[model samples]
Target: MNRIGIPLRVGLVLVSLIWLVPYAWMVVTSVKTLPEIVAAPTAPLPAGLELGAYREVFESMPVARYFWNTTLVALGIAALQIALAVPAGYALAKLEFKGRALAFGLVLATLLVPAQVRFVPVFTLLADVGLTNTLSALILPFGVSALGTFLVRQALLSLPDSILEAARIDGASELRIVYSILPPLLVPTLVSLFLFSFVFHWNDYFWPLVMTTDDSVRTLPLGVALLREQGTGVRWHIVMAGNVLLSAPVLALFALAQKQLLNAVAASTS
Candidate 1:
């Protein structure tokens, strides 16, 4: 068993290294000079460290503006998702209402329907509302997430019914119970929802691309795509540098929240 375990562990380590190699290359390439990057495309370390690519990335585009746009859109979407999803989740999990199950079933059905299938209709509606070229176009459409609603609902369902019954006996309104009693228990779910919304909006590319024609409205992903388009034959190092800058915040956020995210999942299951 020990001999088998040793070889299995070694194989897993090799697979993990292979998976991380591309990301490692991106980091190394970002700091490498153009000539050196071309010379050693897969070098584990920077052949000669240089800040020129990073400088070029900042100089060539409004990277800061792109970052700000993405941040604002992501935050707005997360807030709206939480606002809409939490109450909806609570109602579905606790309240006895007509068509409640039907409504939830419809929401579940929506998960089966790909967003791409509705893209044209959504775009047309936004166009009609005169929000096609604005950040609202990106943020509003994704404000109500089916997955968030489902996750929050499941979390709520797992709570002891006695607590809710006690709240009702004490004459607490549904809204009051939600705010005072249930909300505290839902911190983990809320955090997970926030993280999900943040990442989704941050990394969103297609909807933003379709909605915003102006350079000023572009998010980081769209900005990166535009950079790639314009920077042909200029070496990929500058683009890689821009990618690093764009992704650094997301990576940091995930690293910080990963522990909390895992703990939340474990707590929910327990």
Candidate 2:
């Protein structure tokens, strides 16, 4: 340990606690009865733990189906984004073509514009195509992500040209070089992209809200919101329980992949 390490560790601990407090509160609130929550909403310890909210969460909604639905949509979007993003990114990064700069500029420009602004047009498109209220509606609009393209392009930009040149000298086609050489080199970056897409689409509320009218293709976030909208009025405990369920997969993914995510992000930026 160094002289400043103690304070640094303390700072990190404080930050971690700051980040964790809300989640801890959610857990406490989820397990408490409404009366108990009302009595001492800020209490660190509940008088008694009730697993009832978890039960209600499952019973009041098709949470398991929503889980499956969300998982499928998120994975589908991530997969399609990767498939499109890589080639687009590689083209932007390496290939010299007409309007390349303009194309790249348009992609980066989308990052500045909020998705909400385009929702009306996209929703209308899906509606006209009769794809609304379907999983494809959830997946298609997000399948080609500008952020994913940007990140993969940034990662590709960080690569040395010699690697591609050597492959080219060995009589490999550009497609072959990209397919064979790029994938392994960009695996961590791709994983980072996958993590980003999965977390973002999994937690997205607006698109699901606008696209689907029924529970048949609803995702977890939509399911949670629906739990709050029932005629009986808001059930905070159940809502908190749904929230915990909503956050679990994201938390688990972060716990498992934080190392790779950080390393890949750092590499791309560097």
Candidate 3:
């Protein structure tokens, strides 16, 4: 080990705790009695755990519907984004076409444009087609993801040109080369992008807030917001419970795909 290893390990441990403590607190708060929470908000340990808050969350809201909405939109965004980004990225990375650099530059330029900046134009366009308060409104605007495209492009760029040339020499069409040859190699990067898009759109509050008007189409974040508003006073326990329920999917996704994400990122950058 290096001389700095001990200190570096200590620093990382502290950083991890600093990041995780809040989430741990949220889980604790979710189980605590309201009175216990009020008495000592900063207490790391709950005096006793109860399922009351979680029970109330389910009783008061359509938790299943919220989950369905969130899952539908998240999956829709991820699938459509991959469908579009894979081809766009492949073209930009491999195929010779006029203005390809300019096109790729424009795609990168989108990363700088905040979602807030695009909301009005996108909303108006969707509204013109009468799609507001619908899942389409949520999924359509995200059909192409700039960051996803960039990741896929970088992943493709990292592939050995000789392998692609060999495939071409085997009389494979470009589409065949892309569809058949590239996918196995691109799996890690695709998984990373899928998880990134899913988590992002799942937790997204602002866009859903703007697009949806009713519980029928609202996601968990919006449903959680509604829970807070429906109560005359805030219930921290219930709020935290709702948050825990809301965050479960994202946590599971990360836990399952973390290694793939890390490996793909490392390979892309290397």
Candidate 4:
């Protein structure tokens, strides 16, 4: 056991370091002087702390505006997904309505369909409605999350029927039961869903790239991508700085929600 454990731990540490290499390089490169970056592009450590790249990133673009736009879109998508998922999940899991199986089947079927396949139709629809290049275009297409519904339904399945029965006996309405009773018990699962939706939408690039033509509704990822085009040539330092900023919020969110995310996975799998 000791011998096996040591090798396993060592292998895990090696894998972790490999995964962190790019992120570590991004951070290191972001703080390096332009001269140093130009001279030694692949150096793991910066010789001196320089924030000019960060300053340049801010000055060259509307990073704050991009950040705000991305935040709004991500929050909107996550909120809509959860709000719709809870009821849809509950009904699919607990209710005995007609065509429940077919409804759930439809939900599952959507998961098999790649999102890329729907982009043209969705983009055309948004274009027809003049919602293209709007934040609504980003959020609206993602509002109905089949994955969120599936996770919530699975979580609800693991819950006992007695809870709902008791709520009904107390004369609680279905709406009250869904909003009041189930949510509290579903905290871990909901948090997991919120984080999932939030992170995906926050980091999303292709959808925004397809939808937006200019900076008016451009997201952080798009803004970061634009960094390479700012200067006379590809400014690696400035681009890395933008990437660090792009990744910070997601890293913080995961750090905060790691426990709840684990619990949600455990609960669903159990």
Pick the TM-score winner: 4
Residue 139, candidate 4: Cα error in Å is: 0.6
Query: Which should have the higher lDDT, number 2 or number 4?
Result: 4
After superposition, which runs of candidate 2 have C-alpha atoms over 4 Å from their true positions? Answer: 1-15, 38-43, 168-171, 263-270
TM-score of 3: 0.86
Clash list (residue pairs), candidate 3: none
Q: Give the CA lDDT, 0 to 100, for residue 166 in model 4.
A: 90
- Which ranges of candidate 3 are over 4 A from the true structure? 1-14, 39-44, 160-162, 165-171, 263-270
Q: Candidate 3 at 105: error in angstroms?
A: 2.2
Estimated TM-score per prediction?
0.88, 0.86, 0.86, 0.91
The lDDT for every candidate, in the order shown, is: 0.84, 0.87, 0.87, 0.89
* TM-score of predicted structure 1: 0.88
Candidate 1 lDDT (Cα, 0 to 1): 0.84
Which scores higher on TM-score, 1 or 4?
4
Q: Write the per-residue lDDT of candidate 4 for residues 111-202, one digit (tens) a residue.
A: 88776999999999989989998999999888898888998898899899998999999999999988888899888778888877788889
The best candidate in terms of lDDT = 4
- TM-score for candidate 2, residues paired by index: 0.86
lDDT of 2: 0.87
Q: What lDDT, from 0 to 1, does candidate 3 have?
A: 0.87
Query: Residue 219 error for model 1, in Å?
Result: 0.6
